[model samples]
Target chain A: MTTVTQEAGAPFGAAPPPADGAGESAIVTEGLTKRFRGGQVAVNALDLAVPRGSVFGFLGPNGSGKTTTIRMLLGLVTPTAGTHSVLGLPATQALPRVGALVEGPAFYPYLSGTANLLRFDAADPTAPRTTARRRVAEALERVGLSAAAGKRYRNYSLGMRQRLAIAAALLGPRELLILDEPTNGLDPQGTREVRALVKEIAADGTTVFVSSHLLAEVEQMCTHAAIMRTGTLVAQGTIASLSGGLATRVRIETPDTADAARVLGTFGLADVRSEAGQVTAELGGHAPERINAALVEEGVAVRGLAVLRPSLEDVFVGLTGEGFDVDG
Target chain B: MSTVDTSTSPGAGSGVRAGEARRTPGLVPVAETLETTERHARPETPTPPVPSARERWAFWRLLGSELGLTFRRPRNLAMLAVIACVPVIIGVTLRIVGGQGGMGGIIADVAGNSLMLTFFALSFLVLLMMPVAVTVVAGDSVAGEAGAGTLRYLLAAPAGRTRLLLVKYLNAAIYAYAVTAVVALSALLTGLVLFPAGPVTLLSGTTITMAEGLLRILIAVGYVGAGMAALAAIGLALSTFTEVSIGAIAGTIVLVIVCQVLRAIPELDSITPYLLPTWFTNFDAVLRAPVDFGALREGLVAFGAYIALFGSIAWARFSGKDITS
Candidate 1:
């Protein structure tokens, strides 16, 4: 019955980490670390601050400790060091309010989808039993799983299983919903179905922490994103902010590529590359106008020019040298 | 605590609900109650006072579900079939062979008195089948969940790890008791039809009436079930260490068997009372007319000690484990 502990400064204790001036955070972790036996560091000194009501993307490649980090945040895995809180309470207490689908949804293969939802709902000591029937129906209906409610889980397609797991998360009114690769192994239609559901859930004012290895999925679904690599967080912020830090190449096509390259080189822009009649350069702080003006001043015919912004996928590869499985 | 979605934004089903929640007057602190069943977006129903953690755990629904899952499995039914067949085989063989060699001469009595069949079945149930069956059930309860990828979701439920472990253990215990009772009941029925029904003589050389003897058999059935609790704890303890149920089940049986082998060695007689399965074999000792509580008492102490040692280990391991699956 005594859920919260005061040892080592509980993360929710009037701490600045969890406070969000614009909106309260559903999760906050300060240097959270986990070192498994045999001296294997699974997750290293993670510092996370997830704002409430945002669809936060946890982006990392396979074996990057994304699931491990989520487990630690959900209290399924205790941290070797550091502290975390969910919804302004210690992990132990805040976790109950969090509904998670870690590494895909797992349920008794023998039970019907509806029965599994009921079983999970009943497991929550706080879930009221009287309205359980209504809740189950609503969850299934909302997830578009009402038809498969009577079907056994083993018989469900990967998509149905994922949706059922989402229904399990939706069985109660949750403040924070943590999904780790909710779309893993799903077909395109199933992936789209799940993405729509996540948006809906987040729209309901629940802070969603969704982890995935797909950059395109994160770009499409998340308002904010955090990238991890080899068990450590490399970068994190709003999708816009993370996108802002990466370089946007200035591409130019001209009849005289050599002249353009030489004139563009006057600005000393980083990484200038030229081929045939086109030239591209990472004009970090130089205005596209300045590059164009310099080229025109030197009598280079500029046929076309554009400032191309980096997509989230480009930023992802730049941040972690590994290209994500886009749209999969 | 309760806010029905009232906003009318385009594509506003979830939007309205969230807006209502953020703007709702005097919402219950998020920490107090997890009142999150989205109820038809109707604002008329009064918010129910959410139950405390203690109140939630008190609901028997969780135990019922686990019990249903464990006992309803095909493998569990197969185990019950094998156990049920034990009593039938004993009864039929005793009726045909007309010999009482098993259990040091209790088999012959099983022919005339159905009540003594429980006693005849005791050595087999306690020493072999009960422990194995219990290990399977208890071991599979937690580790199996982990392997199936359900433990991560279950841990995030409102219940704490301590409570989840308790519910799982209790469900397996119920299965243990059910298995023991089924065997005793089967033997009793087989003895009645295959042989005659009359008075039963306890191993202590005292005579008891038929009705009292039947009552004693029921008590023995329950008592044997109690003895199996130690094995359940061992199975659960082993379960917390691995995601594979077979590993836990096999590990439990191996550990218990090693303990039994150690107890059998004359050199280890000094520590005989500390063995895991020694008290397990004492299920028959309680069937005597003047039931001796000394052995049963010592057995209970040993059982409690095993439970405490292994139960705490399970809690500690589970509390800290990082569930990658």
Candidate 2:
């Protein structure tokens, strides 16, 4: 549960780059840019390299181009400029092995889930009838929605609808699954289920690219992450690596909080707070053991000592100068 | 994370766990959860696989699917049924009014001139009914999907917007053709069933048999279908502009009416053939004894031009559209 935000000036300390191979990256982009008719750039110079079989989390604030990037990656919205590839296939050439549920689950309201899947199955030349049916059933079951398989999409709850969207993405056994805010409307339990599902899928070797504002979930589920602000990628790396350079807080509870604070201040720990026999201070390059030793020498009766590691939110704010909505 | 041992119960394995075991490891858990909650997974009972895209788009399959969706709706079905009974209703009313005299003769006289009759019957349809039909079908082609937030899913399926638009247009055309045929057939049957079934004097002082009259009616129906194609194209173009089906429908209807009014001006009479509604009544020349194909030919060119123009606009709009919202 250690969380640390690596500062930009800090040396690069990411996992060793994946071995170069022949298979296409799940999603690759170079100089990707999108500008509206008015010349307002939505996504600017996005050069992303999502390795195959990794759960890549795209983090951004509202209108920060996360959805725009996802749209371009899926070819739903053509990029204003640049190139992208999904499932090792050039996005412009053809997108056969890519399945995405961008924005929301959109299905024919009048058609039953089975009918909708059937229509989609019929739309793809590679999916045979028997295989499509089996896949549809399998997908339905995977989203914990077999019981509501026959229900009209109009009648489905928001969470159920989100699940259906995921189920649709699951169809055809796609090589890459791109989901944007997949757990948008899900309750806590539902969110956990989806998080676990994403992890399982990634573990199984399918490149899963997801975008969300849920920092906690991203911290838990993503092996690699990209953070965006004002239509630019400000940070990209593993969670642990991103958090490594953030300030660490040490909270100490002692018989005499005032004395502990005074002792820490003498050591140049100017930012110290003492309340109710407890003291907390920012520890700069100092270990908990060092602080404990100092307190013991000062005859301070320490009852408890804990280090508070920076979470993803803190790291994100540090990099972007703005905090993302955790609930999003 | 809780070690409650929930897996021991018979139903414990009935949800995501049971389903996940069968799928590829990458997608197992998702498949499992969906299977366990089948009730919420989809809106229909799972069925056997469907034909591939190529097979589904095979001529007959596309046609059948298009026809099924068109006529399945009660409104469309009723329109067809009403059109079929038009001739019978006209005949019955004529008979009740006694022999061809007074009000009956007036009705007969109007119906006697096949061109005038075609115009009279379709004026109501073109002014409102046909627009409504075009709106009902083409307006919703893309806009409805967008409104329902399904456009993203459809696009993600990698469905080319061109193909989707083509399918929707073709579907609307089929319904339009069916509607036209029903109306024409009903008029012919009613005219035969009610009026004197024999050679009739034409406005041009030529004579024609009932068989010729029926042929003329068919031609009129074809013209109406062509006119509807323009309406469908307009609808499609509007559909691409906005996600509001009602807006597309209303906009197309108003545009059609405006075009019709413009075509009526004496100064613009030469350009009338290019207008969808103007050519709609050009079915008149078909009633001549020797068959006057001049207006019909011009009307065809006009219809084709309208289709090309409006169809191109729709294609361009949809191709560049950002459907992510």
Candidate 3:
């Protein structure tokens, strides 16, 4: 279902339907590019498809164009090149159905939390005024900010601000909610709160496309992920697929290491390394059961076997060619 | 690397499998593939139609709220207090200090006619208080949102760029008119109580009845208000260009001062009338017995030109800007 287009460098027009079809995708971008006036390439030829109802993690380092892409998706920034659609509608036409918080939540500091949400919620012309009061209160309650609803936003701590931002996005039941670095600048407790909130949001069957540079953030919250580096998408897929593809090792323990190596060789498993009576191979298409079954059939004493697949961090670092811990 | 409790989390919980080794390593772990209804993902609700009338009503409602917030701010209230004090100062000074001495301007020259004191207050109101009021409200209209990080929400609200800009302009215009009204009404009240109500001498050295004088005062108030509206538009444009509200306000004030200085240059007399501040004082023409519609018309035309020019620039800049801040 990967629809990485060839004309990604071209300007935005009508993008083709996602390979999985439009109804199944929450968001689709083709040839999405942006070149700032100072010759800086903020986003370069990005093609991203987010499936409906999944918590899609947009992973990248700082300055990797995560926020820029979110802006383009929300129609907040006009893309210098390419097009993106949300829920089968052009991004502009799709705005009403989408709820977005970019970078972080920006609200009137002079206004109280509920007041800020009220103003923002009112800006959506589709929201009926009669129900806004209850919706605003419920939103604050869900984010655990109901107690602080009367407090001015300026007085809110970083966590409160982040929660309130999420509440703003949840003022209604949106089909898609785009949050850019939702937990950014929050304390650990705040991060956990926001993470739980995101998890809870996804439970309601809403497609949440959240962006974060922290691998752990995505690892803890995403069902599917895409990694970007220096404004270019490097890898994307279900968490298992992305983790399964790179830097993974399979460890097999047996007394006859040489015979085990010969057997693996016979099985056409290249790059089998033997040490300390154990044979290791890069985990890929080869099934571990087949290895065990062959070793037993060949009369090699198989003591134990294990799959030491690469950690998600290792795959991230390998894909981006930079230390994954870099906060950006 | 993550140790999240799967029961509490939503998407990222499925991990390490048992030793059975039946599932492919590249498959979707234990995480739910999400909802089963992807085929009907698009809701059938027709796209929300943004009716123009609803939009227009929303614009005004937002403007009202914005203005309400401004009126409640200590800084803005203090500015209005100061503007409201001008007529008081003019009335008290003319009553105590000017006694029977004839001052130069139309109202100050009479000194005792309450109708004329309204005219005297505009001398100070038009130059300092009016522009400051406009600057305080308009210069922060767009920039303040960026500074507070609220512009992203407003734009992302899909408050169309042009519509949001229009709303902001109208918000500042409300403040401009409100400030002008505060000054004019205070002056009118001061004129009535602190001095005698009678026929007032016009700038052209002709006497007009008290009713005619009040009518001219109303027109003069509108004239000053129109002038402030022009400055508000300039402030809005400047606000759109910067994230610092202080910078936008200071920039607009500086531009006005520079324009005034430029207009005062004797060698630039040909261009003096074209300057923004030149039209502000044109309300004096309203005090003339034969009312020089020439300068008043010129002043309004200049105001319209300033609003159109600067307002469009704001819309263009704000619409195209990336909300990184």
Candidate 4:
């Protein structure tokens, strides 16, 4: 079952599979946990697995421990319990194979972007100058900020700074790329550019473990996702599978809204509402096509019949019970 | 499909081998197949690069970066310029005042008069000006990153806290040394250009040759450097406690000023040489004939102790700090 799930359709990109099974799993954690001084758990008993070459989106509300999880993966913060591995090596032992940009990408503001890359290259002994420069140039071009390479970071706009951070992540030729809120301050166009770059990288056989609060971005980019609330993983699965189990909403524009609601009420679907000559019902465990046929045969004038598939946000709300102010 | 061999290649199969080997000769395929099988049998993975001794020297790299930042500013250059002009101004004033008193006599007078002037000028520098410069260079070394929200990024790079603090301290030391060198060189050149190059009379009524006087001046500069180093370390130690650079600068200057005021009392004069700023005027004693190496030696030891004491505190605090805040 695990092997079948791992071999599912490659959503981002397809490269040759790991020849020696080296890339079978880029990141794996078992019962990982962290707690602050006040005994408040920031990350709790997380059991996660990210297959090689997959774009895994870690989604959570603000303060839901996404950053904490990324930090632990990068070995910046030690876990309170359990163990994790990256690129087939233990997380504590695989520092070089992992490249990350956690929080805002902090760099020496006085240094040019090229100079900053040089410093990171210097820090990584395995990364030779020639290779690092080639990677840096390629990454800058990939992010569409090659023109600003010579400029100091202090003069860079927020989006440009974010790109520089991404460029830093790409410097190590790392097997797994971890980014925390990489698109935090970007405009829509900038967000799209980063989204495209992430897809491009993942397609090239690098595992990208991204933690973000943007549900829409996660839905568009991630094939596999995990949702966390207050430090606990509430749901984890493939997007298709998670969405498939959610109840689909059905909206009917009927001449007799009251009569339609009365008929739909017999099906025991929860929270049926009526307004403006329209009846909307949350149908549970029933196909939208079957529900529509039933509504029409009941003699209701169906002016409009539309099925609302549950979005990632709806699944998150349904699982957590509390509606998240997603925009906030 | 020819039965797919699910074997790992020896030496982690060449990145392009799997794609390129398809068209290769028969023997090559046999050998490649064997190599792939060997690679899959090994369970232990390759180890990543660990932070070796050489990599740990990022502390020095950080120090160099800090120095670059310090001199990059035009205001720092202006401060250096002011320090360099002090001796020239004193020489010119003495030359103008003692006309026809013979250039040799004017040189002697200027040398004597300049001591008080140097003391007053350097007092302001030591108590407030120099500390401000040291603070500006060292105080922001780590805390500034925290303020700008760059600390986590730097720390996340796994930069060790001890290495970071050491780099900051070294940068502060460089600023102190440079500031002292400028003041000392300016004083020497101004005295040489404005006053006649000859023997200088000391307060002890003994005359010393120009070479001897210059030698004594060099020793005085060393004392200045040591004194400033102590101030820089103290400022750096204070820097680790706060993210605001201005507060560190202000705190250091305030501490120096309070020490200076307290040391000025006649009763406190006995213990003043033990204080960091007390030795700022130790150069005056060096100017006396039969040079008083006693105070200079005491001042050097006192300054060294301060450096070790304050530097260790900075290192200890930073190494264990919970930098996420």
i-RMS, each model, one decimal: 9.4, 17.5, 12.0, 11.9
In the range B240-305, model 2's lDDT, one tens digit per residue, is 898887888788878777877897688987876556777666666775667778877888888788
The per-candidate count of clashes, in order, stands at: 4, 52, 4, 2
lDDT per residue for candidate 2 within A1-328, as digits (tens), equals: 0112223332111221232222446677889999988898999999888877788889887788999898888667778988876654456323435678787677767667776766665554344454667889998999888999999777888888888888888887566788898888789988998998898888777788889887887888998888888789888877777888687888999979888998888777747988887898988787789889999999999999999899888988888777676643
User: Model 2 misses residue B44 by how many Å?
Assistant: 43
Model 2: native contacts recovered, as a fraction: 0.30
Q: Report the lDDT of model 1 for residue A145.
A: 90
Q: Per-residue lDDT for B64 in model 2?
A: 46
DockQ score, prediction 3: 0.17
lDDT of 1 at A10: 24
DockQ by candidate, in order: 0.23, 0.15, 0.17, 0.10
Lowest lDDT 10-mer window, candidate 2 chain A? A11-20
Candidate 1 per-residue lDDT, tens place, B63-95, comes to 877777777788998998899889888888887
Alpha-carbon runs more than 4 Å astray in model 1: A1-23, A246-250, A259-273, A281-307, A317-328, B1-59, B99-105, B259-268
In model 3, state the lDDT of residue A38: 96
CA lDDT of A50 in candidate 3? 94
- Clashing residue pairs for model 1: A172-B36, A173-B36, A173-B37, B1-B28
Rank all candidate structures by their DockQ, best first, as comma-separated numbers. Answer: 1, 3, 2, 4
- List model 4 lDDT by residue over B79-132, tens digit each: 777766765666576667665565654344664543333433443455556666
The candidate scoring highest on DockQ is: 1
Q: Estimate the TM-score of every prediction.
A: 0.81, 0.78, 0.82, 0.77
